[model samples]
Target: MNRDPSGGACAAEQLVEAGVRPTRPRLAIMEAIRTGATRHLTPEAFHRELADGGVHLSLATVYNTLNHFSEVGLLRRVGFGDRSYYCTNAAEHHHFYDEATGRLEDIPGAQPQVVCLPEAPPGMEIDGVEVIVKLRRSRQYPR
Candidate 1:
């Protein structure tokens, strides 16, 4: 795995800093994600990565760990339909979801503009906004 950009904090150190126990599986999982090709990953993909890394962990364990990490603010969970993807980037940002390839990418630079919004109900407040701009290949191209 490549060294963490911020002075090289290992998986164990990252877990501990996030107030999570530095267990073997947790460390391995963190390493798998931090070293992955992409930031957005579903449980199934993560499971395959773990398997390929020679780390034997059940699918249930992978799910549970992901859930735990999300709950502890170590990861962000993005849901679409019946599937959930875990994102390693916890910073506030939007996503571009490709319908054709079922891929999700971070929308960098600036936050999207919220032009208008209706009033909230009694005693309610706006928590936050999650914008997912879905995309698909154009069909008008000459074949």
Candidate 2:
């Protein structure tokens, strides 16, 4: 929509199926996330990607689009302390966040098993599970 129009129409179709209007900016955002060097991105990274591709969007728009996509199950939100990242793989799985490189990778095959969970509040229900395993290289001192 902002630059390339070829993928915009297809993106619109996909967005429409997801019950989203598929506006120009939304289409651009989708294209940015779906086709990129990395599948997982924080809002800041997403904005940078858009910029690199000659597509301009405000930070608020990026946040809004990420929120909307997550609400519709198109993206998975992974959090670390105070930071968050959005992933395109919404399948049931966990993540491995590399602190050294600030990269997120999918850990598929098996989801985390919770032995016991506290009872939900009255009239409340339990949602899905999200586990993020942060990793960093172990430092070795001089022998």
Name the best candidate (by TM-score).
1
Model 1 over residues 28-121: C-alpha lDDT tens digits?
8888877754488799888998998899999998999999888877778888798798877777788999887899988989978776876789
- Tell me the spans in candidate 2 whose CA falls farther than 4 Å from its real position: 1-9, 139-143
User: Which digits, one per residue and each the tens of the lDDT, describe model 2 over residues 1-143?
Assistant: 12332335577777887899989999898877666533677898889878888999999999899989888877788776888888777666788888878888888677677778888999998887777888887667322
Candidate 1 overall Cα lDDT vs. reference?
Answer: 0.81
What TM-score does candidate 2 reach? 0.82
- Model 1 misplaced stretches (Cα beyond 4 Å): 1-7, 115-126
CA lDDT of each candidate?
A: 0.81, 0.78
